[model samples]
Target: MPGGVGYLLQHCGAFFIRRVWGDDLLYNSIMKEYIEILLLRGHNIEAFTEGTRSRIGKLLQPKFGIMKIILEAVLSGRVKDCMIVPMSIGYDRVIETGSYVNELLGVPKEKESLYQLLSNMNILSLKWGRIDISFNKAFSLKEYIGAHTTRRGIPLNPSTSKIDRDLLLQSLGYRILSDINKVSVIMPTALVGTILLTLRGRGVGHDELVRKIEWLKKGIEMRGGSAADFGGKSTGWVVDRAIQVLKDLIGQRTDLLEPVYYPVKRFELSYYRNQVIHLFINEAILSCALYATVKQGGPIHVQRVKINPDLERDCSFVSKLLKSEFIYGPNGLTENMMKSIEDLTSLDVMRIDVENGTDGEVKYLSLSAEERRIGRETFDFFCFLLWPFLETYWLAAISCFALIPQTLPPIEPTWVDERVFLDKAQFLGKTLYYEGDLSYFEAVNKETLKNGFQRLKEMGVILFRKVKKGNENVTMVALSLDWCPKTALPKPPKCSKTGKGSEEVKSNNTIFTSIFGGGKPEPKISLDGTDTPQDYFDETWRYFVPEGKLWELCEQIGRYRREGKNRRDTATVAARVLSLASVTGALLTESDGTGWIKKKTSKL
Candidate 1:
């Protein structure tokens, strides 16, 4: 709602105006009218590039729908070329982070309501850290288009279905994300989270933890990124404040006179750490991989480990291996790796051989063995960040490849529902997590598996279909390749009773395959023995009459009181009900955020 003063001004006809929902962009009439009205009045327009708040902390890839509208307006001559300014706001603590975490864990976001609004007012009393705002210099769309003009004077139009226009948009999107990361606020809580998470929840001694924080702070600053205040305070003092911030602001306990993770708060810790991971991720990847390569036998590293990376070749190889794990720009892995290598060189983390070439090939120095022995913790932290992703990808690849036909079958199934594929992926993911093959942040993350599927899809390693299944159309993802032996791909070695050195070596060699590169049981059985969670959700849903809120109403049905029942248990029940309702025709979630059982389709 508009403020009273603004309403009064509007009543007095200060200016002609109308509020338009983002949904209006979906219709051609609405888009034309909105564009015509804005152009007629020469009004400034604003839109969120990401469309919505990121469920995960990083800047999401910008939605092209709104961008398409503006591009169409310019191309159609409905509006003149305008200056597009990219603005980014970084918060030390996001107001909706709790909801975001839940959503990331598969819980649907609760619909906005007055009660929720009032409930959140308590946040006003909480101490959220600073907000940093950054505005990039405006660039003219006309100039951008003109630069890509052909000799015949034809301007670049996204509507033209040209490769050039697609490339331009991709570049623009990456540029915007890069700008947002540049202005990201590096709070003490974020730093502390990074250390604890990277160390795999291990405690660091007081002096060691303090030194790590200082080292990290200096690295972030050197890269032109901001860190929470460290000036005029002793190292110990800064460390104490960081610990307090973690406890008071985030409710994490890291002070045992040593920094350690609180098991219950690991997810929250990861969220904070992710905010700054991109800053040093590249260096971490390089240094970690190199360190692992050098300390081969004692640790019994993977066979693929390269003890000495040939500057250009091996850097590119490692970067490609890490593609699914990190966000990369349109310039792609090679260029990004080269830039990271240059940065590492500048930081004195590692040096390149400038004076002499090794037998007509490029050569560079790895960190000294002494340093690796001392900095073992630091490298492990970096490598661990990539561990979950690699493990999840490996699980998906192994599972999917196993499904492929080793011998010719009578018939090949064209597709499997996307959900079924994901269920299998999640089951395997959960198994790996339980076996300690995955990281804390990724243990229950089906989204990571989805990404792995997407990467495989993009590479033609897998295929999918949209088909009518009962009353609904479902997506079915399938492998494109025939089955092959485990030996052909990277596989973990068989476990032995003694667990010799080779066994340890084999254990460390994890595998990954990605298209994007980038659970529970019930004992309840009804008379028909078809009592799945979906059935329970369907039956219980009827008690709420016309519609029920999945979260609030389900809580009552399940008798989940906040006091005694764990939040995760309640959250899991709610998430599972919603998931079941979505898959079967049990319930339909409306735009108004209420769930109603579908007519004549209650049973599943």
Candidate 2:
């Protein structure tokens, strides 16, 4: 089957490799030998550290397999020295955007095939605006190991089965990914996507959108990031070109533009938006912290607001809450918060005051009412960047309530399969959007849900376990026993008729409770039979498989055959019975071994 293009690639030095999940001794030995030969022959090797393409445009966590292999080669003296060059490639449009959207929507990804490749060849004529590639200065692996050597003057050797060696590999992988993100170019499509998505279901005037694009470009540049060049073309031209490239996903009104296809296309737009999310992440965190302060009855005084412990604490909490989503520099959270404050002050959006305190010289942040009024546009820009992420986390928190039992102290904790939980979360998110309880539709994303799940686990609010189901190991989740729902979950925003301010509508409790919260009244089913609060949920959210019926049918078929009855006819009857039983739904109770009691059903 390796013909045509595959043959050409193989001839061009491409080789097949498989993911080594276990101790695949033979495969590992062959790969290690192949890599060593390449290094010894002075041939340059290129690898995608992430191991696979990210469904979202953001940089995925690095895979350490090949990296560890290369490191071992150098450590074993097979390769004298190897320079690691990190590279970043940005695209104006990704060809797989549509498939990525489908995958996010719970559609299983299709495996690659030659037929699909040939069918997609027509896309070669499509206008993909620009591709920007940047490479970071190469760092010598030998030198890095030498620099990190312990006081004992011992370099990291693969032969040593110590934790330090593993730590070194992890740190090295993160450094490479960080360097790649640093040099990533901000394309016009990414800028346009960020602006349009920020507006969210609203239309923007062409001139206004273009102005915002220019403003965002300036902000990125000010933050020590690069914007793609447009060959001296005006901002309007850049906007027009980007729109033209994305015309299918974007739509036009009289004099305004907006994203088409509602939530699905929003995922595609978010792909571009995530490319440059790192650039504005710090400002976004600060903006979220400031918003939280205002929501908690702490007014932002025009004169001054203390920034030392309180503001720093809030910022650190926000950063940690989103730690799974964004990558912070090696400087850590406090340092990054201070830098963001300095950046904001330099931009004249806020002023700083140095005050002599009992402990030391404390700093105060002040936003002059006059300055705020003048720079409202810039201030809103930063705050809007964080709205989607905050909304996503809020949705994720609310979805957890569905997993809890109606009783104050349940007989036993209920554990639901992780896949079922996320499916229910997505369904709940869509229902909320329709009912106006949720604002950002894009927040109902699969990737963000997974990331939020990881963050919740890190915060010790949720516990995960693996259980064997059928032939697969299913990941199951349950609320932590030590965690109380009443004090942990964020308060739900008031209904739409309340006319609450935007800040109040999205405001959460302490940053700790903000990402995950508990203690709300049990949700009620709507009056309409079509919608139920617990439609996707039950005492046990497990699917019914009717395994007993199928086995019984097999026994009957075997008995009929022994009695000299028509074996083929008996098997057909069993197949019909199995098909009918598969479609029947049944409620499972604690006595059925699910270990969770069902709440009494009631109409709203």
Candidate 3:
């Protein structure tokens, strides 16, 4: 469709591309020249849709320039019988992924020779699927016009027909889609790879993967694929061919095994896997926003349990950056973002290991300003415009039920969904309790996500169970690994600054929460010496876990301390127990077990 617009003079249509490569303005200029030529040659003017392709698999939002022209022209009687057709072309081997990654990384691609380009084709074999073109039944302009040609035409800028403009775009977009059947290489590979990754974490055999893929291809084929569209020499053959190409690459390199489907190109699997994840992520974003809108709740904010007691030191840096922008005041209107978020039942708060590589496969790894802006914008649109009849509102509530609070692992997809912490009901009698698990919050690749999970285990926030879904499970959403520690020291102060004066209040946020903004997802840390977030609490310690151990020691010595034992002996034992609870805090009293730990340690 991209080059087609460049070549087709008589059949002019809109050009949609991603906002990448700022040459879109030039593309419009070239199109206008070609269109003017065709009109001068007495050919019917084929109007253009000035739009861009989305880098992601979903359709890009259309620009209104072309739509404006079509409306003006049709109303002015500049054209007739403006029949439009929507066509889809699916690629079994997406030529763009290779090019796309290059573009994303700011890598400039060199145009290669015919042989070099062919060698890079990676089509060692391929299964090119048939193109799906939806021929929308044409409608006469008169039907929509609903008005006989007047000396003076209906006003295109009429104030009374504002809703009509929206209705026209929506109706036309869907009508055009009714004719498309093409599946691009990105879509199918994502479908197949996502399934395989889900089922076999290490990967799957080619034959077995193909069987599963065949079932899907065949099913879709039966639904709408004609004999030529698939089956013999069409989409099916192309898909089969694509898989075959992957299998054929086995003998070409020693590193490639007979069953190996890829050469392990640096970003291919990641790019494809991202395509798969984004499908669900996009849906999750849309649905969750809608769910939040109808529920009528306040904005959801999250906090992480602080392992480091150092207040004011580490957070001093983050606090500088931690700011809340008042984009606009909350109102009950469609554009009121805060109010829209307020309507949501819950927020998807995933607990990721910002300290580990938990989120590698995901493309954008951080909670950047751009992402936050998009998130707020998306919430606003869905809450205000989404049809109320849809189950988007209901589904949000149902999803929360799947999350068991406290024990949830903070995986990426788990984010944006409200997390419920499980109660420590089972440990009520045991005054001393301690537990931890690794929770990845950063977006990373498969390797990073795994590494992040393992490392997070060392840092704590551990959960006892794991839940996974789908075939390949690459898109597997994990619980945020929420947990509750028994408060051994029930009367302890609500907040304690590590190494600070006894009267100083610890800030509300902690080192981990401050470093990565608590509401964000798990972090993806790299093992290759990159992305190691500076740890402010690395040397500091929290008393929660340590206090738990102290409680048991207190119970063990309760009788001894209360007995008519020697005062010196009782003080010695009490000092030691209390010493175990102190972390970098200056010794206030001197005792071991019962007394003198502070005086002895300080003297040493």
Candidate 4:
């Protein structure tokens, strides 16, 4: 905040909190006193539990600093009972969508300033559709604590110990967030974005888009979630309105609707989709579990399928894998899976059977002929809701392997800067997408990659260490000491300058020359250049260089340019080499009059 915003906030009884407070005994004391005084004086205090707005449109984990201060004030008898209200606000069109997309694509967020704020004021003229706001019923903080601890037969009181107080704070934080999520209004834009992003291919029929939107709305409502009501407007009208409002991202082509700038614009749409993603997380987990079971040779088919006893395990595994991406209920993974199963059963998409076994009654889940048909039809839709996240995790995992050295016995603890690791993961994601290996383009998101990295760290698959890089401390990621790949890692593709026969090169010489204009033959260097063996890059002089070798090539190019080589010819050759190698966004330029190839931060 800048200019009058800070002044206005202060005048409105808002107190600023420092993110980094060094030796803040006095600051903390004053803050605690001010909060307690406000509570005792019967002043309503509104605090954002998450501390800041989430760039991805989902609820971020709560920050406990202010919450801790407030709770201590109430629990220590400094203040009487206080009411906690969970508030959720949803937007049909976010004004900051472009900036959010930019940040997700690796661009650093711009600091707030008066000039920037004024320059962006033109957004007020845009038709942003509906802004749905919901505030859940307030609850007494003391009663909430008592209710939570009553079942454990250990009541939380003013004299509760530090451990109990901390535990209560943690639970209370999540409980408030869960309530906020529960009451979040699913705007039409959110529904439309979710459907469009989940659907395969670039184009969708107008009728088909509307149909899916309707189906998604019904499904969300069935899950006890509410979609924004447009005064009894028809589903088609809602679709049209959403399409109109999001026209910048989505284009209408006669009877077809397609994303305007695919892959890039998908990130923008994902921001809206993420708003309602939590409502579908359980179903997505169940869908993934079914797929995992099938991949493991379980009896699964279109007509009918018998659920394996390991279904629960599979669901828990999938949920744990996505634990960082979504918030799950406190009822535990198994309990959540059971609830999803019950929901599906109620919808007649599946059924359960109780049978007597040696260990008493056992329950088995199964899908009948008709139910299996319905399940199959809906399975892909549910899976689509989570496919982007899975793709992000998969890319993150592959980048870990990609970062490791290619050797007989792999490097023990290969480490890379966290920023570089994310960049590589995003680059590989785009490469895979262009090569048709990855389907979901939005998986190249930075936030999702960060979440995946966090989840991997939590799972002990990777370790994070801080190392000084220049003036700043950078986080370095490495494989955990105890972690081992289940299968042997693949060796890096070998490269050779003369590996491709001259005859083969001659055969494709015309096509290659036409694509990249023929230039004077370059003098051979002492560098060990290797030919790419992949069919995608079969042309001679083009190679698939690994990350380590890629940098060497950049240095080689720089050296050649320094030797007074033709700038156009040098850049042309470099571009062709990197393009075939699938590093599309890299730019070869003269930085400070020194020829250097630098990669520009971009999304796929």
Candidate 5:
């Protein structure tokens, strides 16, 4: 797969992987046999420590299932003291990013097939850029166990203690993840993506972008990070190459008679941008906080202009705020922020003073002439990076306020399901997205939405409880303010019955719209007089009625399309309807199969 030989070796003549799916239960037994064969037969075994492909572009928290088995074998003396090595492989662009985005949005990932396998072979010809493979430090299992077994609170023999064994495996797994992050490479695609996106769709001219690239090269170099494909080249040359690559994927346009990226391509642009977000996110965050203090007239903005941030407090605040939006290594913000401060100091953007006291108060100062010029161009970049998350937080706060009644009354948190709250947040988030209040890609993200809820919870805006619903217990939230039981527990909007009585409440808008277009329609009319195709699309979704089958939904779409005169664009109409449904927190797959359904908009 790495070298693209899978396309040529159609019959798997010499190259083939014995796949062990992470989702399957019975595969555990197969995996055990596979491992035993490799260990005992003196064969090398390669495994993805992440257990599954990363859907969010960053390394997900490692699953301990496979790691536990491997550790068990070593502890049982089934294999000799094996050398454990951590390796990381990164691509400038991944082939599965589009499908990954869908899966992350809660769509069921389609099962892989032979036809799909052959279809993906087309990626071999694409300009995917370079592959970076980095090998990290190796450690032996014997040495690892020997060093960890005698920890103060751990038992002497892990075999006799399940808790001790589990802890040891978890610690080892985290170590491997840390090693993986250390070796990850930075690619030009990610660099370019970050630069363009930082502009927030306000396209930058060629000369200006090249200058920004030079500034980034210096910043990255100061942090001792590698930029792939940038070896020994002038910044202008590298920027030109990167822009050409982006143009190949998303066509270019001229804005104000200067070469600029197409703004509408930001979604695709964000994917590549996210690939390198981890490397400099902490630095960007620190810069923002300091700059905000200076701009907003704090002690830092005073005559001396040396900033003193409550290191632990400010860093943790920013980290929690951006946790969902950015991918970070295992290190906490405290440690990472300190490192960032040091990097910025070296870059001459900050300074640390120890002469006044031993605490080493950090000071922020205006950049040098050249540096100030760079900062001016990139100031909005920092603003764009943090704007969406701040908007999400405000949206969540508004939702909580709207849910609560004005009069004070005591109420428990168990009335509202946490899952339902998240659903509502995303649905309303899309509303805000359409209103131009939320970023395009961040609007539908579940994790970011969850972070918004969490931030509100921490701020005492909402309190939560665990409530038993059906066979499972769900986390529920309620306003921390006074509760009026009658109105506090809101239900889904009561949809009136229309059109067919016996069959579902599907609408026949042709006659109603034809008649109503020339006159005022009744208030209770299913098809509003001013309704356009978009309004109809929004209204038809309510017929989903919380849940239904995929085929049944398709049939409903067919009925709706048949009512209209435009039959030529059925496929496009069908896809748009379904996509809108998904974004609005209405459509989802059935638990056990390929069937699809809609989720309730509010509690009932």
Candidate 6:
């Protein structure tokens, strides 16, 4: 069977991408044993059955390549007692299923690609399931293949009977060699499907997830399927068995059973759940169908169609169209069409609703008689273009969102690094720093937001659908590109205001500034403002400082602001002023009168 043993070996064959066909690696002396093994085994004819990946428990409809090759061998009279017995060998676990799932989804692997190579290195393999090998009864080839070679189980000669051919193929499809219910797939799939479905759309807490899992055991029993059947654990034990399998698969923590108070482990639960998600489609079509609904989410938007004269006709038109398509388009208040419309109300996508009134005796309510419009796209026209495209991409979009954590290029410097300059990027759940912060430039907030849009578009995170909040705060600012090698955390600045970070700066301020400044001579301020490059000095200084306060000083003040909340202390103000004078020599000299700028002080 394709999904059986043939599928497992085919998976092995598929790993050697691009080295097949004309490549000598397979047929040549390089991997001669590998090729010989195939020929020696009845599977030597070498045709990969596509349907094996899905919809079957064993080898599927045989393709012509293997049959034709065998026929040629028979024609040349090289075959004597050729008996083909197809065997299905299921593994305890598929080691490299992350790739396997992709293949099933119609994304064939191109092994020659560099990105895939890098991706493979990082992939955490989920452990295999128990091996279940079912061998089909052997078939003799002499009578069938001697004179008239039957390909695809259909005889070629005009005199040959079609009825006989059909029976032969049907036997090949349905004959059970040795079926193993112990490792049959339905259990693993059903167990996982139940777990995920119970997850609903939100992540449950550890305690709650456990309780719900226990609840599922009873529910599954009530539903006429054993909760532990696919997973093949004792009754009410699937959860433990699954976790065990996952723990074994990951090979990270061997001690999985050590008090798993949570349904899954703290850090590793996501990985286990994701493994289930990987096989979601292949396991069961009903499960996949549930996933389809979950993929779309609750509803798009809910429109209350008022049953009116002209509007009724429009509603009927929409209802008829929706009904034809099998989307729930019931006439009353509870139609799925209205529910879909309701889903859009929360997320800020563009949409419109219209209403009109009539005289009291014949008055009624309904949707707009005129077609719904968004700029130029009518509602019907929009759904017409939208439905099929959404149907295709909706799964992709869900997986995109679900797999966001899995695929995220590991943030090079995870924490806020001074060298990296993005001190904090994540707050709560959403990304904290806007892309403009990384771009670092002097631009209007709008331009910064626009830059953020471009960068995020490249990142392919969320779309630029709508900006609900923080649009003003988000801006493009070139993050400090200057590097500071971290030998250790800097000592605190001795200054009254600055924190520990300022000490390193104060000790080697001149040397450090010179190195980073690239020999740009420090302005020689005369207090007279003569040839001072005060413009350059002031700009660079202003770039570093804000409102004449050094960045470090501002940081200290921020700390005080957080802890103190009120500047109620009198001495604190005076000490800070004196400390500023000590740091800035300009405070000591009288103003030259060229531009008299008085510095604030705690004038005691």
lDDT of 4 at 599: 24
For model 2, state the Cα shift of residue 495 in Å. Answer: 18
- Model 3 RMSD to the real structure? 22.8
lDDT against the true structure, each candidate? 0.51, 0.64, 0.31, 0.64, 0.54, 0.29
Where model 3 places Cα greater than 4 Å from the true spot, the runs are: 1-50, 105-163, 174-191, 197-200, 218-240, 246-531, 538-604
RMSD of 1: 14.3
Candidates in descending TM-score order: 4, 2, 1, 5, 3, 6
TM-score of 4: 0.75
Q: Give the residue spans of candidate 1 off by over 4 A.
A: 1-26, 147-159, 228-242, 248-264, 288-295, 298-335, 342-348, 351-359, 362-365, 399-410, 441-443, 469-472, 482-604
* Candidate 4 lDDT for residue 533: 25
lDDT of 6 by residue, 309-413 (tens): 433344333233222111221134235333434432332222334444354443322123332323212222122221221222211111111111111232221
lDDT of 1 by residue, 394-509 (tens): 44554453333323331453344465445544544443344333344454455556666776666556677665556765665654643222222112111122212221111111
For candidate 2, lDDT tens digit of each residue in 1-604?
Answer: 4378778888898877876445778878888898889989998888898898888778877799889988878877878999999999888988889898877766678888788888989889879888999999999998887776653266555447557778778778888888898888998988888888766335677777887888889988987789999899999999989988877778676532542322226768888888887888887777667655442334456335568777777677677767777777777777887888888877787777787889989887766466567655565666667666766776565555555443444555667667756765665666555544455566777888788878877766667887766776667776555453432211222122122232211323232132123554322222111232322212122222223321432232222111112222234333332222111101111121222234211111
TM-scores for all predictions? 0.67, 0.75, 0.37, 0.75, 0.64, 0.29
Residue 234, model 5, lDDT: 77
**Regarding lDDT, does 2 or 3 come out ahead?**
2
Higher TM-score: candidate 1 or 5?
A: 1
Model 5 residue runs over 4 Å out of place are 1-37, 104-111, 119-123, 147-159, 230-237, 248-251, 254-257, 288-311, 320-335, 351-423, 447-604
Model 4 residue runs over 4 Å out of place are 1-4, 21-27, 153-162, 200-203, 255-264, 294-308, 351-368, 371-375, 402-415, 467-471, 484-491, 494-604
**Model 1 lDDT, residue 586, Cα:** 12
**Over all chains combined, what TM-score does candidate 5 have?**
0.64
Point out the higher-scoring one by TM-score: 2 or 6. 2
